[model samples]
Target: MLASVGEIVVVRDGSGPEILLVHGGAGPRTTWGALAPLADRWTLAYVHRRGYPPSPPPQQRQDFEVDARDLAPLLAGRPHVVAHSYGVLGTLIAAAAAPGSVRSLTLIEPPLNYLVPDDPEVARLERIGDAALTHGMDMDPAELREFLRVAGAPIGDGPLPAGVVAGVRRAHGGRPTSEARPQLEAIRDVGVPVLVASGDHSAALERICDSLADALGGKRSVHPGAGHFVAAAPGFAEQLETFLHKSVR
Candidate 1:
């Protein structure tokens, strides 16, 4: 069923405990398709984030502050929150604002370069991401390819498909990751169970995840092979299930 909360379209599925699945730049299916089997044991509320179809486009550039506003209402009833990529910025903000309102948090490969500001490698990736999101369709082929690689876009990539092009267009002018500074202390202070996971493909990303894990006093896991899309990597679903079970309050 579709539920409209703060203009966000949530597609609910399965039954059992609830998990609010927030998609990032690539949209919901690409972000969480690998977790489909988990719906058998848990209710999954798939959120179509702003700028994606079904959900209205953002008023201006896609900003996490706007996303936090959209997501705040969905946190009601304390559903376990699982957000990927760009979506994690807003999730972290909302969770920090009202820590007790979330059952748990599982963040996968969030581009939280601010978490490791001193890491030049992380800074390099952040610059590339910012340029890609800001320029979007205007990006040159080489630059676009690099962005797709970092984003784990599933494409064999001869010529870009219309759908992929559209996705890129939607991401145009998105707020940069360098601007994301979620209140890690607030989440930590409230003792929210948090899991920060990343693919072992990029040492820079793993560094950011490691730093975020330390800041939030959370567990960290590396599920390699999927690059930025760690959710699709082998053993990810099982590990996520176990983490969710252990996080139950």
Candidate 2:
């Protein structure tokens, strides 16, 4: 069913315990479509973050702080929260605020580079992201492509889709991921079982994920082959299901 969690639009389907699925720059379907089949066993709440259609856009740009405010009220049920890419920033903030309300937290390739800020590769990735968001569509084609590549956006070699372009535009001038300093200690103290997964496609991302896992005292898994779309990687559903099964509240 379609419902509103505060101002955010949410599509909830299936049965059993809820698993909130938060997408990053990509839409819900792009991020979680591969896991739709899991609805047979678990309810999936696909959050339509601000700047996405059906959900109202943010008052400013696509800032994670706005997302955190939007997501805080939705955590009442202690759902297993799964967030990807940029969405992870806000989700982390929300979860940290009410750590006991989260059953388990799974993060996919979030650009929380501050955890490993000294790494040259992480710095490179951060620079590319800043450039892309700063320039948006005005960025040089090659630079934009490089940004998209690091972001795991599946633009391929074809002309950019209108939806994709719009998503990029919405991201223009958004808060940089490095600026997100979620209360990791607060979350860790609550003893939430956190799982940080990476695609193993980028060394920089892997390094960041490693630090995140360590800081959160969470298990880290690398699901190769899907690049940035780690949720769609082969055998990922099974692994996630296993984790969820063990994590159920």
Candidate 3:
């Protein structure tokens, strides 16, 4: 059966403890591949954020708060949340706005820029992100390439993938409504079990992940050889499974 949270597509699979899997700019399919393995332990609810196909086009401007609002109702049961990239921003917001709405939070390289604003590496990333948001869908190819690189796309010498470019365009317009510091404070106060994970690559992302972990008083893990896409890294699923077991017990 098809279900939606305010026009955002929600796909569910398996039968077990509920786990909400929120995808980033890459959309729901980014989490689809993990369903089969996780389904044994988790009933997964994969969210297709607004602007992604099959979901409604973005409503007005695309603030992270908008995404958080869409997610609030879905967290009625305090499901465990595993979010990546931009999705992580929304998940944090929702968790903060509705205390106890999130049983546990597993963040995969969340781009919470405000977490480490003073870091030189983070400042460089802010410049790239600002450029992408400014250009929106009209971003030039060169700028897109750089943005993808800074955002941790594994794009090598080849041209940027059309799908990835499209996803970036879809997500580039909005600014975050709330800053990370306050959200972190709220989540910390709520006493949610938070786990911040990032790939060993991407210096900027690693730093942001570390700072966020510190702020939330959460555990931190760095996946070797994984760039921004830590979810797909080797042994990621196992590590996550272990964390889930330990966190809930």
Candidate 4:
């Protein structure tokens, strides 16, 4: 059934302990299809993301917090949350806006770059983003996509659900963008039990996740052979569930 809060496409179902899945960047709900099997055993809420297809029309509040706010009410009494990329940013903001709404958080390559300025890679990222904008996305979306993959944005050749791919094209606007500065600042103050992780292949992800761990005082993990989207990697769900249940202590 559709969730009462956020975009109309927001949905929650399943039984047992609850887990909210939020996709990073413009990827919509189905981006979690590989991980959806977990929902069968655990109550699941796969947020459709504001402004995306299957969601209500977009409002003016494109800022990260507004996106985060839309998902807040869904947490009515939910406990655990799992978010990736931009979704991680929103989840963190949501939990802060209403700390009572969430119990624990698992962030997969959150792009919270508070101290990432010094890295030469960050410089290259800005360059790549600019080039992507100039090159026109579809000209070769794969090039830019791979950049994000290295930066923890997850890139794959598998075609996404049609509506989901369309939603990403609309919401992401074809760029390997940086985190919104204000939102980055807000994350530094989030007080919660968060497990921040990055793939061993993602250097930029490692940098930001390390910064996040330092600021939030959270534990960290690294998935081998995975880029930004660990959920897309084989065996990721098992690792996440194990971490969520045991080491999150």
TM-score of each: 0.95, 0.96, 0.90, 0.76
After the best TM-score superposition of candidate 3, give how far the Cα of residue 48 lies from its true spot, in angstroms: 0.8
Question: Which regions in candidate 2 have their CA more than 4 angstroms from the true location?
Answer: 156-161
Predicted structure with the largest lDDT when compared to the true one: 2
Clash statistics: count for each candidate? 0, 0, 0, 1
Question: Which regions of candidate 1 deviate over 4 angstroms?
Answer: 155-157
User: How many backbone clashes can be found in candidate 4?
Assistant: 1
lDDT: worst 10-residue window of model 4: 167-176
lDDT of 4 by residue, 21-108 (tens): 8886546444577777787788777777765657765565334666666777777875688888767766777777666566677888
TM-score of candidate 4 to 2 decimals: 0.76
Tens digits of per-residue lDDT for model 2 on 1-249?
999888889999999899999999889988899999999999999999987879998887888898998999899988999999999999999998889989999999998888886789888888788777788999888878887887776687888878678778889988887689999998999789889999989999999999999999999898998889999999888889999888865
RMSD of each: 1.4, 1.4, 2.2, 4.3
- For candidate 1, the clash count comes to 0
Query: Candidates 1 and 4: which is better by TM-score?
Result: 1
Worst 10 residues of 3 by lDDT: 174-183
lDDT of each: 0.88, 0.89, 0.77, 0.64
- Cα lDDT tens digits, model 1, 1-249, are 888887779999899999999988888888899999998999999999887778888888899999999999999879999999899999999999999999999998898888777778888788888888878878677878777877887656598777778888888888887888999899999899999999988888889889989999999988988888788999999999999999988
Best first by TM-score, ranked: 2, 1, 3, 4
